[model samples]
Structures are given as C-alpha cells and as structure tokens.
Target: MEKYIEIRGTNLFVKYLNPDSRKPTIIFLHDSLGCTKLWRDFPEKLGNATGCNYLVYDRLGYGKSDPMPTNPRPSNYLEIEADILNDLLIKLQIDSAILFGHSDGGSIALITASKYPSRIKGILCEAAHIFVEEITLRGIYEAKELYKNSNLAERLEKYHGNKVDILFNAWVETWTTSDFRNWNIEHFLHNISCPVLFIQGEADEYGTMAQVEKTVAQVKGKAEKYIIPNVGHTPHKEIPDQVLDRTIDFILQLAH
Candidate 1:
C-alpha cells in the first residue's frame, strides 16, 4: 500500500509497494533529473518480486519535496544527502537501509554509504560516476544542445514543476565546467565497508564501465559490477525485466 507522510515544513509524498517486516530496506534513488514518477512501475514491481521493503522518494527541490533556492556544491552534497536521509529514515522509523542509486543518485548513495557505514546493509550503484572524464564533458555538452532543441525541458518540467530552469541549468553547467573536472571521490570509497553491487549499461551515454571498475578496485568490501549490453543510461527503465531479474538475484544472495 502507498501513503503520504508529512515532513515538518514539507509534505513527504511516498509510494510503497510491499510490507517489509524485518526484510532489508531497499531505497531507490532516481537519476540526475529523475523523480519517483520517472521510475514508473519499477519500484512497485521490484518490491513485489522480492517482498522486501522498497522505498523511493524525491530529493529536496526535485519532486514532491521542498525545493532549495540554490543548487548545492558537489563536495558538500554527499554529506548533506547523508544527513537529510538519516533524518528522513528516523521520521519513518527505519534505522537501516539497502540503497539503489542511479547516475547522480548513485553518487549520492556512495556518499551516504561512505559517510554512514553502519546504517546500510548493502548498496547497488547503477551508472555511478566516481570521477570526471573528457567523455562526460562531451556528453554534457551534447545534452545541453539537445535540451535546447528537443523537448528535454518539457519532459523535465513535468517532474520539476514550472521552475525547470532552476534544476536543469545547474546540473548541466556545473559538471561540464573546466573547474569541475577535478571532482574525484576515490578517497571516500575506502570508507564504505558494506557489500556493494555496481550496475552499469554497456552503452551508457553518461559513463562507462570504469565507473564501476574503479569502485571495485578502491572500496574495501565485497564489491562486484554487472554491465548489461546494448543499453543506455536508464537500464532499469529501458530493460525492466532483465534489470528486475538481476536485482532480485543479487538481493536474494544478500538475503542469505
């Protein structure tokens, strides 16, 4: 069943699909410009497939959550996300979680997992970016061009409300900047002490297998990566059944 919970200043709109009683809590974090709606039915479908506690929530200023007046810097983001997520879990009375994050959300998951090592059961990072790359900048530049010519803004507007500019510009301009190239989280990867499963599409436009490979090399835990062929950035959305199967198998192994 699904219901809405109210945050002190903002209403926390929630969508739950199963009753997870003592099962590992699996929290789904959306992509860079994704909301709960963008995930469509994956959350519910996966929830039923595993019968574990599945949760998906919009980040502040993204979906139903309160929008911040400014975009947060990358260095400050992971910690801030961890703090906010800790608070959110407390409000929901959940003390631990198994997180699944994609793209930017995957970075957020890495941050949270590294910062609060004791609060997580496992982590599944999909299309996660650990360092900046030339291809990344080229892709962002292409995205900016496409957003101007295509309905990218229109499609994103549905998720961000009328202030699409507030969300889009910041994400684009920041990552592609000359200064943002030095963005690296390899130092923090050592702090993550739980099991981690890295998922990435072979043809992901945003990043390549290195994102997952580097993580497997750095993190001092049981870590592995699954690279699906002929898929793009949003593998779960593009290949739902395959993604569900892989995720289910991974989770089941952890369940033991």
Candidate 2:
C-alpha cells in the first residue's frame, strides 16, 4: 500500500508491503539520491519470501517529500534524521522493527539505534559510512561530474520531479565541502544494543572495508559482516540473490 505520512509537519511518501503480517516490520532507508521508488521490487520480494512486513519511506528533501532548505546542512544531520525516524515509528504505532539501511540510510539506522536502542530490533547496513573517507570524497566528485555531463538528471526526474537539483546538490555539495569532511558517527555506535549486520562490496568505490570493520568493532552487541566480491556500492541491487539469502538467514535467526 502507498500512503502519505506526515513527519515533523512534512508530508512524506511511504510504501508498505505485507503490512498486515504478524512478523516484525523491516524498514528500509534509501541512499543519498534514493527514494522509496528506487527500492523498486526488492521490498515486495523480501516481504513475500520472509512473510515480514516491509516499510519504505522517502526522507524529507528526496522522493515525494518536502524539500530541504537551500542552505548547508549540519554535520549531525544523520542524527537528526534518526530522531525524525523515531517520531515516525512512534506515530505509526510501530513498537519496534528491524532496520535495513543503505549508504546514507545505513548511517541513519546506526544513529537511530544508538539514540533509540529500544526501538530497533536489529539492523542491517550496506555501504554505510561511519566516517568520511578519501574514497568517499572521490566517488562523490565523480558522481557530480556524471550528473553534470550525462542524462542522470533526466533519469532521476522520474522519481524526484522538480526537486532533483535540490536533492542532488544537497548530497554532493554538502559532502564535498570541507566543513563536513570530518563527519563521523563512531561516538554513537557504542550506544547500540541490538544485533547488527554490515554488508559491503569489495569493489565499492565509495567506501572501504574500514567503514564496515569500524562499525562492527564499535557496536556494543553482536555484529556480522559480509564483503561481496566483484560488486560495487549497492550490493542489494547488484547481487540481490546473495543479499536476500544472507538477509533472510540473518533476520530469521533473530526470531529464535
């Protein structure tokens, strides 16, 4: 089901799959340029296979949600996003759920778990950065060049509409700026009490194993990691079968 939810007085788009199931909900957070629509059929596939309810939402300034103000964002924006997520879950009566986040979404999940430990049953992070990396800065720079010279904006228009420019700049301009270079979330990792699974691509241009290892080392609870060979940033999209198999096994084990 597709619906519009009000979070912090902003209208955000949400899509639910197998919402009535008795299983715990699996909430998916999208990457920098990602929205609910970018998730495509992954949620439906996961929901059907696991019989778990799935929730995918667009954060403010991306997808169908309201735009962010045209100003520089604070380094702690992910922490702020975590707080907003907590409010959304509470308002929707989601007592607790497993969080599945990718890239920026993954960082948000980590912050959320650290800030609101009781609200998350488990967490899975893919290409989630704990701190800024030189590789990350280079990736964003290349992506900006691609957007400027290619049809990327036109393709992204299908999801972002007129907000594409705002959305793209919000991610690129902020991350590449020197003021945000030292951004890191390691301080919040120790506060997380739930089990966590970190997934990364060995060939990822945006982050290194340090991103995954650093998070796993700092997490207070049990943590597992899988580094997929021959894959880039987004493993769920690039290697769905492996991701689904691994995720299903991990999540089902949490039930016991």
Candidate 3:
C-alpha cells in the first residue's frame, strides 16, 4: 500500500511490497534521480525470490516527498541519509533489515550499516561509490548535457513528476561542484559488522571495480562481490533475472 511516513520532520513517500509476509524486510534505496516508483517491479520480484518483505521510499527531495532546500548539499549527505533510514526503520518498528541500494542509495546503505551496525542484517550495494573517480565526473558531465539537450527531463517526469528539475539539479550541482571532488566515505566501511554483497556492472560508466574492491577489502564482516559483465550501472534494471538470482542466493546464504 502507498503511504506517507513522517521522517526527519518531513513526510516521505513509501510503499510496501509483500508487507503481510513474515519474512525479513529488504529495504530498497534508489539512486540519485530515483524514487520508490523508479525502482519499478524489482522490489516485488526480489521480495518473492527471497521470501522477504520489501520497502521502498522516496527521500526527502525525490518522488512524492518534501523537497529539500536548493542549497548545496554537504559531502556527508549520505551519512545523513543513513541516519534518516534508521529513523524510518524505528518509526516503522522494524528491528533489523537487509538493505538493497543503488548508486547514491548504495553508499547510504553502507553508511547506515557501519554507523548503526546493530540494526542491519546485511547490505547489497550496486554501483556504489566509496570515493570519487574521474570517470564519475565525466559521466555526470555527460548526463548534464543529456538533461539540457535531450528529453531526459520529460522521461524523468514520468516517475518524479514536478520534482524532476529540483531532484536533477540537486544531484548534478552537488556532485559536479569543486568541493565535492574529493568526496569519499571509505572510513565508515570498517565499522560494518554485517555481511555485504557488492554488485557492480563491468561496464558501469560512473565507477570502476575499485569501488567494489575497496568495499570488500575494508568491511570487518563477511563480504562478497559480483561483477556482471555487459551491464552498465543499474543491474536490477539492465539484467533483472541474473541480479535477482544472485541476490536471492546471497540472502539465502545469509539466512544460514
């Protein structure tokens, strides 16, 4: 069911798939430009595959949630997002959960797992970045061009509605700023005590293998990596079957 949950003083849009199930919750976090709807049917599919409940939400500034201030976002915004996720879990009475996050969301999942280790069961990070890379900037630059010259805004409007421009600029302006060039979150990786599965596409334009390698290298608990060839940044979207199968296997293993 569609619902609005007050979190961090804002009504964040949320949806639950298989909420009646007695299985563990797998919370899905979207990318920079994504919302609960943008995750498409992956949450339902994953929930069925893993026999888990699923939760997906739009952050404060994306989807149907309240818009954030247009001021430059901090480099620690992911950390803030992690805290907010924890708050949402508490408000929902969820004691522990598995996080499935993509891009910026992936980074947030990692941060949440590390900073609030007691509540996280496991994490699945897809195309998550631990440090800024030159390719990331280049990809952002190209995306900015697409936003300006193509129907990118129109396309995103299908999912984001009127909040498309604000959400788009928030990500573009913040990431492309000079101050954000050195942004990194590797320090928090070591604190994560839960099992982590790092999934990346071999052809991801925004980041390289270093992102996954560094994540698996530093985490204190059990960790695994899966690099899907011929796929770009969004594996759940690009190759749903493979991503689902692998993800289900990982979660099943975690259960044992």
Report the backbone clash tally of model 3.
0
Model 3, range 186-222, lDDT digits (tens) per residue? Answer: 9999999999999999999999999999999999999
Question: Which candidate, 1 or 2, has the higher lDDT?
Answer: 2
Candidate 1, residue 186: the lDDT equals: 82
Candidate No. with top lDDT = 3
User: In angstroms, how far off is 28's CA in candidate 1?
Assistant: 0.7
TM-score of each: 0.92, 0.97, 0.97
RMSD of each: 2.0, 1.1, 1.2
When sorted by lDDT, best at the front, the candidate numbers are 3, 2, 1
User: Candidate 1 has what TM-score?
Assistant: 0.92
Off by over 4 Å in 1: 1-12, 71-75
What is the C-alpha local distance difference test score of each model?
0.79, 0.90, 0.90
lDDT of 2 by residue, 1-256 (tens): 8888898788888887655646788999999999998988887787777778889999998888888877467778888999999998897788668999999999999999988888799999999999999999999999999999999999999998999998898888789888898888899999988999999999999999999988999999999998899999999999998999999998887656
Going through the candidates in the order shown, the clash numbers are: 1, 0, 0
TM-score for predicted model 2 compared with the true structure? 0.97
| Per-residue lDDT of model 1, residues 87-120, tens digit only | 7777777756888898888887888888777778
Model 1, backbone clash pairs (residues 3+ apart or across chains), number: 1
